[model samples]
Each structure stands twice: as C-alpha cells, then as structure tokens.
Target: MTALSELNDDVVRSMSIGAVFSDFDGKINCLDFHRTADLLVTSSDDDSVRFYDIATARLVKTTYHKKHGADRICFTHHPSSIICSSKHNPDSNGEFLRYLSMYDNRCLRYFKGHKERVVSLCMSPVNDGFMSGSLDHTVRMWDLRVNACQGIMHLQGRPTVAYDQQGLVFAASMEGGVIKLFDSRSYDKGPFDTFLVGGDTAEICDIKFSNDGKSMLLTTTNNTVYLLDAYHGEKKCGFSMDTSPTATIEATFTPDGQYVLSGSGDGNLHAWNISDEPNKVGSWDSYIGVVSCLRWAPRRVMFAAAAASVLTFWIPNDAKSEPGAPNPEG
Candidate 1:
C-alpha cells in the first residue's frame, strides 16, 4: 500500500482533464468505476444509464428508463451487471430497485420497499448482496439473485449508506450527524456501534470508506466534507465548499487514500492532502456547471467528475513519463 505521506501536492495539482463526454441531457447523478478494470458506469437524471471505456474515453453502452430515471447506481460483483434505485411509477406502491443485465439492458430483478426516493445504494465488496437508504426513512438489504428484500431498518431521517472495503462492516448516516455501523453478518439485531459528529446540523449527502478501511469520508448538503476514523469514528478533519442550495455534491478519496476529492457548485474540483495538515492542495476549474458527482478509479491515480451534462476524466501529467505507470490514453 502507498503511504499517504509520500504523496505531494504537485502530483495532485498535475491532474488535468484528459477526456470529456457530453451527451447526457440532464445532470449526472453518480459515477462508479469497476474495481479491476478501466470501465465506468454512470447514472443521469436524463433517465439514462451509460457505460464507458475509460482507457479509450468513449461510450460503450447506453440504456434508458423513461418512467423513473436512474439515481444511485453501482456495478455488482459481475462485470456485466449493475443495480440502480429509481423513481416509482404511478401504479407502483413504492420505488423500485432494478438489477439490470448490462449486456441486454434487461431487468433481472426488482427490489421494492421504500415509500420514497432511494437516495443511497451501496454494493457489498465481497458478496452479491447490497444495501440501500431512502428518503422514506428506511434502510433495506437485497441480494442480486433474489427479488425479495432480505432485511430492513427504519431511521428517523434521510440516510446515506456505505460499505467498508473489507465488506465486514457497513455504515449508515442518519439525521443529526449520527452514523450507525452494522456488522454485515448480523445486521438484523441492530447496529453494533454508532458515532456522531458534534455540532453539525447538515444532512449527509454521501458516505465513503477508504480503500484501506482506516478512514471514512462524509459529504453533507451544508457544503462541508468530514473525515473520520473508520473504527472509532473520531473526527479527523473537515473541508468545505461553495455548493448550490439544491445540489447534492459528492466527495471521494483517492485510490490510495492519500487525498480527498470533491466537487463544488462553483464549477471547480477540490482536493486536500490528508497526510499533512488538513488543507486544500489543488483545485481544477471544470467550467462545466455545478459538479454533481465525483469518483476515483479503484486501482489507478485517475478520477472522474461530472457536472450538468458533461463527464470529464482526469490524469496526472507525469503518469505517461513514469516507468511502469499505466497509460491513461489507450
């Protein structure tokens, strides 16, 4: 594993926009990169789901859901499959979580239960089972092979959920800056531990566990991002941005967990060096719109950011010159 102290601000500042995909008609909701490949999956408010070849920086597949547009999307354990929580139709009693076969754009399974929009969805790192948190004040677990929900937990307010890298623990952020951690093996009995961020009244927009499982990142609607110790949930530091009043901006850590990246309503991408004093190290003007979604590649130094209708791929300028470095350009 790469040490966080070894990363410098220059390398992060060297990141430049390498490619851009601008075909979506609405704002990009989320971006997910394959754990072992250069493939990328994205969901948009335009009612479309897209697959892209990151190396070639081209669209590989495109599918649409006209009725209820896709929101939170993630790639399953299978390379050719994905799951997304979408809006509920008129006749439906609740929202539907669709597991789609990417090869044919067919719905393989539908998990339903949330009475409102499902705002958070995260796939388990080691299993086919995944979990979701919704505006309906519920968190439900599902398996990709089955249509029935496995378990459900009700909360007081909106929730943002995430799984640790080891898949042994999952965390759900609820109202009042509280985070509930559950053991994946026995979640039905209730959370084994809970952590609260003091003095924060913002609604958490998203939560992410570092790849090393040592740290966690939380993005809130109040334009702030909080870093915490994954095990004890002690607040390490926090970063803030100028976010739009209605936008749910996201943030993520680099693959090595050295730095934090976030999008801003000011059309800039922000980065902070986590190993040093908590401070802004780099900022790139995307110049697209309010950056709505941000994600880092699972095994590379690259990352992707999306705004209103554009997706941009970023890479370090010296990546090509470094010996044995993976080429960003195909």
Candidate 2:
C-alpha cells in the first residue's frame, strides 16, 4: 500500500521559489515575517536585528536589539509592534525587558521575573495575552491587555509553548518527552493537566497547535515528527523522514493539519504529508544552511524558513495533483 501510494501521489510535485533574501554579518538565528503588513523581521548572532519590507524586498532598519545575541523574534498581532527575546542569563539583571521592542528598538517594555534565558515566546492565538517560556522551567502569561504579568505556570522541565486557536496552551518539554496542555484562564493556579509521549527517543525541540486547535505537531532532535490531540496533548499519530537529523530545532503544522514542516541543523527544509494513516505521503528538501526557524503565511500561499544568513520562501507545486497529497504550505 505504501509503495503504491508513493507511486501515485505527487507529494512534492515541484517547488516554487521566491526571491531569496539575506542580510547581517552572521547567521540568521530567528525570523518572523508578517502576513498582513508584508514585513519581515530577522535576528542574528551578531546582537543585531533587521526589518525588511517583504513586498519590496528592501531593508527598512537595523537596531541594536540584543545585548548578547538574539534567539527568536515575532511580530505581535498589533500592526506596528514586534516582540524579541533571548536566553535568560544571570549576569544580565534587566535582560528580559531589554528584549522587548517597539518602533525600531527605540521603545522597550520589560517582562520581569524570569530568572534564566527565555527559550520560547508566542502571542495568544485568541486573546491579547502573550506567553514566554524560559530555561527556568516555567511558562508565563503577559497580558498586553493590562501590560502586566498575569500569571506563571510551572513545568516539570524547560519547555516551549504554542497557543491553540481557542487560546489553550500546549507545552513541549525534554524531561518527559511529552506535550502538556493548560487552559490560559486556569494558569494562575498551575498546570491543569499534561499529555505524555513515552520512550527514550530524543529531546523534544519544537511544538505548534493546529489552526483549528484540534491537533498538534512536535519535532525532536531525532529527526522525527509526532501529531497529537491539541486539547489534551495525546499522541494520535507520528512519522519519520529520511533526512539525516541535525539538531532538529523546529517544526510547524500546516494550517489545515495535513502536513508537518521542519528545519534542521543539516541545512535543509523538509515537508512531510501526515494526511494519511501509518505512513507519511512524501517529503521535500531545500536551502543550503541549517534551517533554524519555520513559520506559515497562509495569505501568501507560502511558508518561510531561515538559515544562517538567508531566508527562502517555499510554495507547493503550482500544479494540482492527486488528493490526500501534500499540496503546499497550507
């Protein structure tokens, strides 16, 4: 059955390439391109971050955004605002607040109380609340609504978080090799419950909620992907790719939940079809350096991935193929 499907399906019919863009003197450590505004933000290992107009593919500005180095960045749902973060270091007392920026890093807001490097940051998919996870083994909620620390939810191990469409939280941790789920409303008390994935496979690297909040996708250092029930974090399905694993650093689910996309230390971008049972329909490869980040842009019909100093846009094969096959970034 697997062999027959492989012959019949155009999982990766072809790849549509966009204008490749790059900047900065060092590796592009993190990237987030805005969908509506057509703005692209990239942070580098050189303690600098740059903004670019994607439609025009022109540099807008450069700012001393990070003191040591930037690890991740994202544009807030707010039109002109962006949020940036770094690993918490004890030597830096006000590092967390220094990381948040507005208007080319001129104005800053501090998020206090996290004692270690911040590992993950995300905006709530439903509400105005934004979240940050730290190596300190805690995930915190910040209400931009009130501009205050709303609550702190402790985790068993350092974890990365993703907010579902309904605003529920899903945290992926290496300690238990599982994803934990929590209601943003009940976060003040503690984690409401957790869904555990067993066996000593490898450290969990990234996690994201499906568009509808009904499913989730997780990646690991072992070059593997797992899909789960988003509400409870239950492992519903999983698949492995042929690409050699680097530090399989990030994974994202397509908006429709039919595909899993990831970037790795091996400098490659991979797409896997999870629309079927017991087997992944197909996979694809691109990019020349370690792909450290991946983000979906539905309005543009493409997804973006960042390597050391480059950004590449990937679109599904423009030609229509069979059903139940990987179409595009979806």
Candidate 3:
C-alpha cells in the first residue's frame, strides 16, 4: 500500500469532477461517506435523506421526514443505520435526534433532548455512540443501543462537537472562539485542555479532527479556517480568501492530511497544500450556488462536493495509475 505522504501532487492536481447527481428539490445541507463502504448519505432542506452507491454512482434509496425534515446527518458504525436531527411531531414540539435504519426506513431510536435544532452531529469513530451540538447551547451524547441521552454538557455558545479518529478525545467549539478538548472516557470531569481562536464576532460553524488524530480544523462564518495541534491546542495555520460577508464557508482537510479544502460562496471549491506554506493549490468552479458541503471519501482518492441542488464527485484523471508513475498527459 502507498503511504499517504507519498501521494503525488500531480495526481492531486489532476482531480476533476467525474460524476454529477442532481435530484434534490432543495439545497443540500450535509454529506457523509460510510467509513467501510463505497456508499454515501446526504440530507437536504427538502425534508429527505438520500443514499447513493459511490462505486456504481447510483442513487440507492430516498427516505423522507415530511414533518420537520432532516438536516445534519452522520452514518453509524453499522452500514444499515444513520443518525440525523429532524423536527418532532408538531404537537409534541421541538426537534428529535433520530437513529434510523436505512434497510427498512424505520426509526429504531429517538434521542429527544435537544431543546433546539441540532446544527452538528458526529458518530464516534470507534463505537455505536454519537454526539450532537445544538443551538440550545448543549452537547448531548447518545448510545445507539439506548433511546436516552447518555451525557450532556452545557456550553456558553452555540456548540460544534467532533470526536477524534481514535475516539479517545472529543473537541467542542463554542462561543467566544473557545475550543475545549475532553477525554472521551471521562468527559464529565470537564475539559482537560482549552484554546481560543478568532474573536468575539466570529461564529464557529464546524470542527473536524484529522484522519490521523494529530490535528483539528475549525471553520468559521467569518470566512476563515484554522488548523490546530490536536494534542496541545496550538494554532498551526489559518486559511482564508476574499469572501462575501455573509458567506459561511465550510473547510475540510484531505483524508491524507496533505491538503485543506473549502467551499466558497463564489461558486467554487478551493484547496490548499498544508505540508509546507499553506498556499492555494487548486480551485474548481461548480457553476452552481454556494458550495456548502465538501467531503473527501474516507477510503478512496475521490471526494464529493454539494452546492444548491447539485452534487458532484471528483476523482483524479489518472486515478488508476500506479504510485510513482508519471502522468502520461503531463
């Protein structure tokens, strides 16, 4: 197997959109790839959840939540299940965090605790547990086998929660540009480490840990992305470009941690090389609306980007070439 550090820049530059799926009636809110399968799931404002087979580039199933509608979604350890936040029955009030079985479109569990909309949801990398950050200023943890919230933490700001690749540490980004790191095994003791970023005016939209669990990435509504040392909470780098004041650009690190990617309101996707000086390396125009969601496939040399109602999958032009091989067209 080729080491990720050995990935050729030419291969990275050769990436191009290979497939486009346009079926959503509304904007795509989130996209997640199954860790162990060539499958992906997306939630949209259209109140639906759709699954696709990445290998076949085919839409496999579509499920609807007509009442409140689905928003953020993450696939669980089980291939046939997913957890999403959606509205509850109108009469009951508030929203519900649902664990749904894709095999039969049944909601196997409902973790109903968030008093407001859940803006962030992430499944634990090593177990059937998951965590969610909500506008209600709380982070709630849940176990798939149970219907109740296992733990909860109140935050001073709207929270964005994520578990590291090893599931040993979980980070929570909250108001006032504060990020608190907690030991997953004993989070109730309070965060063991904390770091601050941005300013009072900045709103953190997302937080993600690198695949190797060595670093973390934070995306802000201020159109800036920060790379931080996961072990010590030290800032590594910050990425940004000229963007609209209203743009909520979401950024992500490549699966190999060699590059960082973000979607801009200017209808383009941007990538930066992170190994050396962080510099803009590539940009692709989607020609659609604001590219809101961007995700690299966990186990392949491909990624998927969504903007408005369009979804596009990108792959290296010579993806099948052997490692260390020169590009024929170059």
Estimate TM-scores for all models.
0.93, 0.80, 0.91
Against the reference, the lDDT scores of all candidates come to: 0.83, 0.62, 0.81
Candidate 3 lDDT by residue in tens digits, 100-195: 999999988778788888989999988888999998899998899997789999998889999999999999988888999999999999999998
Q: How accurate locally is residue 90 in candidate 2, as Cα lDDT from 0 to 100? A: 33
TM-score of model number 1: 0.93
Selected candidate, larger TM-score, 1 vs 3: 1
- Write one digit per residue (lDDT tens) for candidate 1, span 1-330: 122344568878888776778878988888898887778999988889999887666788999998878888999987779998885472365756888899988988778777788889999999888999888898999888887889999898889899999999999989999999999999988899999988989888799999899999998888788999998999999877896966767898987787899888777888898875677898888767777788988866677888878888877776556554433442
- How many steric clashes does model 3 contain? 0
CA RMSD, predictions in order: 2.9, 6.2, 3.9
For this target, which candidate reaches the highest lDDT against the unseen true structure? 1
* lDDT-best of 1 and 3: 1
Tell me which residue pairs clash in candidate 1.
none
Ranking by lDDT: 1, 3, 2
Model 2: lDDT of residue 160: 78
Q: Any runs in candidate 1 off by more than 4 Å, and if so which? A: 1-7, 88-90, 319-330
Off by over 4 Å in 3: 1-6, 87-95, 198-200, 244-247, 319-330
